[model samples]
Target: MATKTRVPQTIDAYLAGLEDPTVRKTLGALRTQLRKLLPKATESISYRMPTFKVDGDAVAGFAFFKNHCGYYPFSGSVVPALKSELDGYATSKSGVTFPPDQPLPAKLVKTLVQARLAEIAARGKKPAAAKRKAPVGRPATTGFRVGVVRTLPMTAPELWDWVTTRPERWLGPGATLKAEPGGQYEVPKRRGSPGVRGEVRVVKPGHRLRMTWQPDGWKKPATLQLTVMPKAKGASLHVHMEKLPDAEAREAMRERWSKVLARVA
Candidate 1:
């Protein structure tokens, strides 16, 4: 069984769930920095995590996990722009993970935020022929339905266990799963009901697990993979889903899966 951590209903609730005093302080500082950078940005919880928006677009987000913390600038562009200054940190094109005890430098954080702002502000300057799809909130075709990665303060083995075993604390009564390749993963559609069926295509204990995930309306199953990697603090949980039928399906399931992933974590 995994430790029981309360799900925050709001951004305040989410911040309050930060058990470490230092974590709470660091996140508070980061939030303050974000506000100063984007004074007009609104605060909201997108993808079940705390996020800040500017002009109705997501500018940044931050979250605390078991071992470390994460900061997302909502674009791959920002990471590369500041990559030189981010050496000695684990960074991907999307975001970076830093030790919670020692948050990323204030200057670097500011630079990352500034890069994102410049990217957003410069959008209007692009030539009509060179314009890319509209930003997330606008009307533009998107690449994937949803793509996200989260880090936690737990070892790979622990995260692997948590991912394989689930409780009905949130969605339903309980869940049934196996920790092997070509295994079964069934959960109740509702409390006290028969489980919706699914199968695991690949399982590497404590490292990676790929499974078939079928939602309620699906004509066929789309593949969902959970890759767990060791982190300085605990582990990094990477999730990807594909074969969504349409943009509507992707948008709908993106929210639903966001909630489900938080719980499964």
Candidate 2:
């Protein structure tokens, strides 16, 4: 008869079972930091991982995998909300994964925890009028939209490859686009200039794409959409952007996308 293996039932037991010293030390430190940051949170093993719960809600958790370690906020929105800050890490809708040798930074961990707590607090409540105002230099959460469309001399596959392979052409120099939902992209700041960061929200290979777009220093992201369709002559490229701060921004992006489309054409 084969013997049954035991599973860890506590955080300490989980740590003790880790055979790799690097992973053990890294995750142990993370546990300590999580406890400190979430002093009021109840700690226990949930879903086979070490989890922290607040007010009967699981707010955070962590577990080790074959190639990486993961940090879960237990909220689908938290990871996406902080996509700009999480450029170098691998993220899914539910968790962020990092190398076992590199623990998540304390500042980043704190920010993640705060975002989760704020989300929990905001539930079942309405915001005051004052709280509805956009952060400085940001557009209101609703209103102000612009779009531009152009027909190009290429097939849908050719256009998709052109755009996805060389996203920096439109996204800015040094930009990267993963071209899949929940995948992240960023154009790093350089020489005192601002850069862009965001995550893909939708993707329909060779057909359509939608993403959140936010430049450096913006408090919230705006939405950007791109669509490709087969045309009688060639293919059509449509660019739509929303959540502009004012008429000036609307016109600016309108011109920008128009120029980009012209270049593509």
Candidate 3:
């Protein structure tokens, strides 16, 4: 007869059942941090993970996997808000993953919890939306910003080289990126007329890069940030460009980045 695996009914049982000592210790530390951050938050097994709830809302959760551990914020927007701080970890819209041996810092975990708390508090102040259904393929627009995220099959270092060396793949033909703070780059005029130019503002090789982007006709440059996050399988590339002129520009950039990601994938 086959034996059934016991489900953990409590956080303690979940930690106790973990076979890997590193995973156990890592999750144990994470639990301690969450408890300290949310002293009054209730704990339980929610969605098969150790969850922390505040005011009946699932604010945080943690789980161990075969090769990595995950910290779920239980909110779609939190991870993206903290993407800059989460350079070395794997992140989706809802969760961030770190190596079992290298747990997230206490400060970072506190920031995550605080962000969720603030989000919940803000939501409480706002009026609820109507019962009408929403449209599909709706673009997330905030001041004409465009953000795109894609998980690719390559590692962080591999992606860093692939993108930095092949600037034309996304930027344009005859484009260049020096990949250093204050380094200048340009995209030349190809078929018609105008070109684009900018300077790199920040660079963390194989992890993150930030720069300015201005076309020939634009008066002000937009800010562009690209982050490569490590994952259990490969890595995720996040392309965020802001200060676009309008929704049309935002949608166009979104589609452009989507195509870039698909090509890389």
Candidate 4:
């Protein structure tokens, strides 16, 4: 039988065992930069790595290991313009890593942090006439598109409370959810119509929510996911809808979620 892997319980313990002093120093600098750039961020150990939280939400973090130091932005994507600069390091969908001895690019890191903060701010703003430009190019495409709608009076805690404690308030009215994995969540209506349904495929609190949506009375279904994150100022919410069969479906779902998010502002 296989045994479960034991993980380090604290950031300090994880860092104290590092063999390289230079890596330690570099991570130290990175931590300092994080504090300066995101003053509200707090540090802790999560997933056996150093994690940072903002406004009581995990936003970004760093970890020093044997060969490299990892930097986690937690934001979905950094600004498009920074792609070239980020390429200098090892990057993934949610993070980057730099070699132990590589000189830390403090400014680039700062830029990335600011970009994430801006995204959080935009997410918190009200629906307005002029929209913030979508992240410059096609979002990394996926397999489906899901739409979410909610209306709650504007307040930070109110929005958080509704989303965390009373998800059913909005989702329940038009949809049905089961606690079991692979259970179906059916949305019974479209934006203006009635009697629509969908299926819930994924659910993780304060982390991810995914479901399949079919327009009321439509034959086809699309997938939707919402990823919730805490940022230095407030929260970072990302809506990814996929399996859209056409441009019109994609655009319509985007508009619907964007409008609902504006209400939280």
Which predicted model would earn the best lDDT? 3
Candidate 4's clash total is: 14
Q: What is candidate 4's TM-score against the reference?
A: 0.45
- List RMSD in Å for every model shown: 17.9, 19.1, 13.4, 13.3
In model 1, which regions exceed 4 Å deviation? Answer: 1-7, 125-265
lDDT of 2 by residue, 1-265 (tens): 9998687888889999999999999999999998877777898999889999987888889999887999999986678756667999999989999999889999889668766765554331225665566487764354466656666898888888887788988777788889888999898887755888899987878877778888877787887877775655676676766676677766767678878878767
What is the C-alpha lDDT profile of model 4 across 65-143, one tens digit per residue?
6577887767655533245567667677677877888855877776566555544533333244334443556553344
Of models 2 and 3, which has the larger lDDT? 3
CA deviation > 4 Å runs, candidate 3: 1-4, 129-265
Clashes of 3: 0
Candidate 2 clashing pairs, residues 3+ apart or interchain: none
- Candidate 1, after superposition: displacement of residue 92 in Å? 0.9
Clashes of each: 2, 0, 0, 14
lDDT of each: 0.68, 0.78, 0.79, 0.60
lDDT tens per residue, model 1, 214-254: 76666777666666656556665655555667767666655
**Model 1: worst 10 consecutive residues (lDDT sum):** 139-148
Q: Order of candidates by lDDT, top first?
A: 3, 2, 1, 4
After TM-score superposition, what is the CA distance of residue 264 in candidate 4 from its true location, in Å? 31
Tell me the deviation in Å of residue 214 in model 4: 30
- Which RMSD does model 2 reach against the true structure? 19.1
**TM-score attained by model 1:** 0.46
